[model samples]
Target: MKQYEYKFSFLPEAINDCEKVSDLETTCEVKGKYPCPCCCYNTFPVPKEDAIAYICPVCFWENDVFTSSDDEPSDENRGMTLNEGRRNYKILGACSQDMLIHVREPKSDEFPK
Candidate 1:
């Protein structure tokens, strides 16, 4: 318990400031010579057609969807295009906020390795 240096928790304010961010909302097709997040190869195909995510063949970094054709690509949306944004995906938009990853200090007497 003492070994733990810090813990992070979601702030209520974050809800007001938090924007939708999710892989389902941000994955985009990387056509042509574009670097793959995994192998940095420019020829990676769209990994998940349904999810629109990118998986590098060389490095094989699957589930690394983070590309958008829109002018604004951000972490919240995992880099999705404007048309395919959260607003476009109702189910995803609802769960997208869960990705915010709020944390809390250990309340139990457990040491982390």
Candidate 2:
């Protein structure tokens, strides 16, 4: 497993008089860009690999490599199916209705080459 690290910071005024540091870890295998199932945009990391909760910025679809079929319900995606997400992306500009606020329009560079 790969040991990923992350760092976080808090505003000095938000935490009163305290200082803290975190050594977060993970086994994420993010790599080169690939097509996102929901948006068909080449902005996803790790082609066909376990997505490890990477959310697509363009479509807000939670990546789940286990979701192989368009109609398959994805447990990692709040019981939403890929087809449902794709339909939502087409009409609402996001994978799900609620995700509209979290998603952004795909940039020209994000499209498949």
Candidate 3:
């Protein structure tokens, strides 16, 4: 059985460090002002060290944006403090065995006719 490893990032900076790929193998790219996953729409690479929270690009428009309190700007007029909302967005990824094996007996030569 072959095992595969998975890696994820939510920022452009982190994806930039990865070896440039042909947009085929799980990789990253820039789309407009946001970072996009080269392989899938639900996945994008983000800088693990970045302070700002990351949201999935595919769902960003539909979902409320999230930001960490530490990264939020200090302001008084802002209806709700940056810290008021959720700090981090959920990110999902997985890795597992990529191969399967099966055993079976050969078909019999007997004919129905």
The lDDT of each candidate is 0.38, 0.77, 0.28
**Candidate 3 runs further than 4 Å off:** 1-44, 48-55, 58-68, 74-82, 87-113
- Candidates 1 and 3 compared: the better one by lDDT is 1
Comparing 2 and 3 on lDDT, the stronger one: 2
lDDT score of residue 110 within candidate 3: 15
User: How would you encode candidate 3's per-residue C-alpha lDDT over 20-89 as one tens digit per residue?
Assistant: 6675576443332323211123233343223143433332311113434433542321333323222212
Q: Regarding TM-score, does 1 or 2 come out ahead?
A: 2
lDDT of 3: 0.28
**How many clashes in each structure?**
3, 0, 6
Indicate the residue-level lDDT of 107 in model 3: 20
Residue-level lDDT of model 2, residues 25-52, one tens digit each, is 4424333378887888877767647557
The C-alpha local distance difference test score for the whole of candidate 1 amounts to 0.38
For lDDT, the strongest prediction is 2
Top TM-score prediction, candidate number: 2
